[model samples]
Target: MSLRETVNSVDTNAKRQACMELINEDYNKLGQYKMGEVQSRNIMIIGRTRTGKSTIKLLLMDPRNVPDEMTLKSGTKDPQFQTFHIQQQEVVLNIIDTPGLFERSNVESDIRPDEAILKGIQLCANMEITKFHAICFCVALTSGINAQDVEAIEKLIAFLGDEIMNNSCLVITHCESKDEEQRNRLKLELEQDTFFKKINPFFKLGVYFSGSLNSDDYKHGNESLKNQYLTISDYRKKLLDLFIKIEKPFPISEMIISQIRQANDSVEQKTVQLEDEKQKNDELQSRIKELQEKYLKEKCLADDLRVKYEQQERLVTDSRVTHGQREGQLKNLQEKLQQKDNIIKRREKCQAQLGNDLKKIIEMEEHQTKKLEDNFYGRLRSVYDADKIRAVFLIPVRRIITDYLRYVITSFTVVK
Candidate 1:
């Protein structure tokens, strides 16, 4: 996830994951030896001038049972680096106590306090062994919320952005009130302010009411400072818990650098995406052209096929007309053939009738010839016994008989 997502949302797990990302990267750079080793973590202390950022830094290192080691010295003007350990955990802590945030000109140069702190945090990032774990914003409750305080915070937020802001906690310090009612009044004032709410939107991690670590000029045992200092034990423990909540420690400088590099990368990414889109659009246009040409060719083919179909239809119509005429002529020829068949049948009947008539005529002629032969035999026998008047007829008959007998005898002799 991006750094903006980690800080903009109210999800602790997201912020933890973001911290781990930088931590794992640092581990990679540290090499194989540090991979399994628990390395030291760092915390950045930031606040306006005289808000006791140095006191918080020292108290964290060692909850002071006594006053300042060197009484003459006041607040640190330059970035101070210190290392301390917690008894509960084995991890070491490197504190980067940034010089107070304000308008003070640098003693050696014209650099402002905010600019110096930026350089200091960058310096912390350069250290190979220590990574910034959490940030602590020191606030003096006795002053209540003021515009000057709000201005200082806005400057810090502008410098670091939300990544540093979200991982940070507001430390309410310098509460001199001894009575509960007085402390409640301070709390009520802080609660009503819009600026305090803006900073501590998530959780109020640490508040120092009893212990006050002031400049060397201010006596350590002053009742107000003493009361604030007495709260140091709880602050020390709770500050450790806040760092633990961060889960992994990474340099704030790394986050700033990463975000800057991402902007540069987006320019290049945009160019590549545009080129890819243009290539895809060109391919689509080419495909559409091919389909359009194919459609025109198919349309021409369809037109030709339609013309041929119309010609075939005309031919079929002509053939049907011709077939109808041929069928009519065939019917007339069939009628003539039927007439010739009737005439042939009548001729065959007449021929059969003529054959039967000829058969009857032949039978009648045979019967008449037999009857005439019988009559002639009877007449010749009767004339043979006739008297003298028939003598002449008998003489002729006898002569005829003699001649017939002679002819018969000669025929018989020729036959023998």
Candidate 2:
């Protein structure tokens, strides 16, 4: 080969070795990067403010070397990524440490800690980490359980889901000086808490205690400090083992986030629907009340009208009775008046007949008296002296006959 070809060949081999080393580094730091193989086990540490979430991450990264002041005071305001390499078992651990969920801030920002953490998880997809092998919920042993802790846990469960609880574990920090008995007592207290009781069944990985000594204590060569460090290391090691042994990983992807948003929207819609239904029910009840009042008023009016109608009917009946009595009385009065008129006509007719009979009797008496005088005078003249007979007999007989006639007439008139 020529000089130029040799130089090119050496450069090519150097580049090939460097690439192999890079690939090997990636394989050791993360698990086998090959598709379909179990890669690095991803873990997310979550907790409220100042609960030692960052401290736990540091200790897990280097359990033998105590964290310096810088690492201890490094409050994570954003998601921090770290990798742990276990060359002996060829296991890799990828950890994402998030900001405290309940950290107080004077400056209000649009992105909340929880929202930022979700964005960080989304960024992990670019690194080929689509799921979390485990979620560690860190709570300080010194900080007694409070409402804030409960609220943070509830928020996490709401955002992620109850499925996340299946791969979760509790980490009690600040337990460096606590004895086994004290730790057990704290655990029992946690179990007894109402909020913990509801979610205890979902913690499949169980609880753990993490305690760490400063670097200064480790450098003093004290046996007790060394033993304490070993115990802390063992606790962290067990946590890693648990992560590696997880059978399934909780998915963190855009699709999952979308699903969570949809669920929240559905709950809001149901709440609105319930409010609308309650309002409608109230309106219907009001309408019913109005209708009842109207019905009562109408009923009262109907009753009054019925009473008046009954009264009018009674009046008409009474009037009819009075009218019938009046008609009968008028009929009797007419019959009496008719009888009086008939009696008056009969009396007038009888008076007229009596006057005619009296006139006829007077005429008959005058004619009879004249005839007797004429016959007596003729007889006296033939039998005796005319002058003497006329003077004596004529006078006496005339007087007697007149008297008799008067008596007869008076008696007959009285008898008739």
Candidate 3:
């Protein structure tokens, strides 16, 4: 066989040996109860971390191994098994002490609390030791059962099934320090606790207060210490007797195992889904950031364009104002030109009237000259009859005609 196969074989053998040990322990302890036949009474002890689960197991099954002082750290990291035999009655008690439920570990290699619990139950079930005579749910009395304890109890029930409580009982530890009145008050408080009341129906054997003293305290202590130790021992015996009195054992069926397997698969699927959703959210955020940057760039561009447009508008308005001033100057110049054209038209009209008046005066002067010439000609004819008289009249008439013609010529020139 190969090395891998050999290792696997060894592992299988070891597991079988462990199971056999559990079985043999039960058979040896309860042989007489079955009328000379071998039988085992299996009991499962469960509780939260540091609730004295392992300590309770040691004190009950092997008192000699009980520690002198309680350790602050957890004792059981995995499932453990022990068997106790009552010498007189020839009875066996097979006990499986499991790691605490809901235990937090800083170590990365440590198994999860729920996984550890399932592993412990599976281990016991593999031995065909499915039936449990008693399922002792341990709690520290000093802690006084809080919400975490209640949640742990609920988780245990979910794993093992509700019927496990049929043979289950509450085991309150650290009761040795409490006085009678204090113990009574604590019990009353437990009775009022919501979880306790809820599970009260299945707890036929009810709750048990378990306490233990170290060997040193028992042997060398004072009277009161010894009495307390004896009382604690008696409580342990009563717990054992309760296990013996159970008529039926709580069975761990295949259905419960199948349910646990399904639950594990569901948890894995949910983890994968959560990772996918987170990735999608990250991508969406990145896209949103990109869009916001683009929007800002566009807004800046728009603002620049608006400023340029306003500048251009101002330039156009100034041009329009200058054009209006030029138009007013042109209109004034046109009005002056129109006034000069009217004056020129009036001067031309006056010059034409003066020319007409000068032509009439010239015509009058010509008429007067003609009439005077006619009168002189007639006198010359009369004087011609007498030669001397005719000569004198000719001289005077010629002088007057000359003077008057010259005057008419000067007046016409001046008028032109």
Candidate 4:
């Protein structure tokens, strides 16, 4: 039988198997995922020493509560890194229940929870486990935002960077049988406090009434250490929203940079092509002009030769009535006229070919230039920058929410 099924059963081996299965399930569900693959969220529970960090983790992972078998408890009191998977919606959350921030009691001091908290932070930062999507900062609701709590949270924030805290949240636990009104009042009091206000803007806070989870005294009812398991679904929803906020900001900046580089490269290639087309156009125009000039010169020479031939023929006709010497001059003028006509005809053919070539060059250059303009302008407006920044910042906000909820509950109930 699975660990979850056997948790309430009498068999000890079944219980141990349940624990092992819970650990495995937790590991499988958490971390980045591919398409069609379910991705898991890593939620690190952090708080001061003696603040029910382990208790809360135990309750959350207990087979009586969470019906999962793959929950693995790893790490030490110095630097804990426990993994557990909780199926919520489309994704599974891999919760990393960390050690308390400081050593609160000599009894708990043997475990060295503070070091464990730091190590958990380091692990998340290094991407040793996927960066914690959300952090649970357990705080005492009665004490509100205390100096030690503040200091521990600040150290965590400093280590994780502003991004992680923005997504992390506070949890006010152990609300001593008081109803919602008392919890709300406590929340407001904390919010109004100077220290709370400073960190309030960055984190999301939540409240939970957790008396205890030790179910051994089943007949005693209220006297039983584990009586109620508060849902706090409202905060849970908000926490989910925080996740959306944290994850929404995709790396658009990197995408924009890459797009810009591609556009620049395209522009460079087009500019080179444009230059070549322009050069070719200039050459074609010059060639056409030269051909036209040659054709005009040949036509002028042909006209002069024709005129001279006509004048010589007239002289010969007059000379025929008087002298035979004009005949020879007429024949020479006729020969010159014929040669000039042939040269004019050849020049006209060359000019026609040059005109057609020039037209083609002009059309080709126009087509190329138009294409270059479209390509350059298309990339100019393709990129979006604001969306990318939002994606990066949103992840931090979700983490803040998780931290806030965990802090409130753990603080109120867990006694030092």
Candidate 3, 1-416: lDDT as tens digits:
99999999999999999999999898998756565544568988888778888777766764444455666667777787777776556678888989877676776344455676676776686666767888888888767677666666677777777877778888888775566677779779877988777656656568887776645565666466666666667777888788777878888787876666576568779888988988898898899999999999989999999999999899889888878888888898888888877776665565556555655655565566556556656776676654554467655665686677667656655654
Per-candidate Cα RMSD to the true structure, in Å, reads: 32.0, 18.6, 17.4, 54.9
Best by TM-score: 3
Candidate 2 weakest lDDT stretch, 10 residues: 65-74
Could you tell me how far off, in angstroms, the CA of residue 154 lies in candidate 1 after the best superposition?
2.3
Put down candidate 2 lDDT per residue, 1-416, tens digits, no spaces.
Answer: 99999999999999999999998898888966454433578888877667788778777777765655533233877777778776655667888887777665656532344564554565465566778888888888767667666666676777677888888888988776667788799899998987777657766789998877755566786677766677778777888778767868988767765664565467579889989998999999999999999999999999999999999999999999999998898888888888877876665565456546755765575566557666777777788887787777777776786677678657655654
lDDT, candidate 4, 1-416, per-residue tens? 88876775767877889998998788778845634555556667777655555555555555134212212332225545555544544565556666655554456443343345545644454444545566777775544567777777666555445665445677665443445677678777776888877677557433343333334333344553332433333333445555444552212133433444455567679999999998999999999999999999999999999999999999888878665555667777888888888876766665556555645654564465446545544554366443453356534544575466556435533421
User: Model 2, which residues run further than 4 Å from truth?
Assistant: 1-38, 68-74, 108-113, 215-223, 257-416
* Candidate 1 C-alpha lDDT tens digits along 136-194: 76776545556655666666667666555555666766542345676667667677778
Point out where model 4 deviates above 4 Å.
1-36, 62-76, 104-117, 125-127, 204-219, 223-227, 230-416
Better of 2 and 3 by TM-score: 3
* Candidate 3 local Cα displacement, residue 287, angstroms: 28
Q: Which ten residues in a row have the lowest lDDT in candidate 3?
A: 62-71
Best by lDDT: 2
How well does candidate 3 score on lDDT at residue 90?
67
> Where does candidate 1 have its weakest 10-residue lDDT segment?
202-211
User: How does candidate 4 score on lDDT?
Assistant: 0.57
After superposition, the stretches of candidate 3 with alpha carbons farther than 4 Å from their true spots are 1-35, 62-65, 107-113, 178-182, 214-223, 258-416
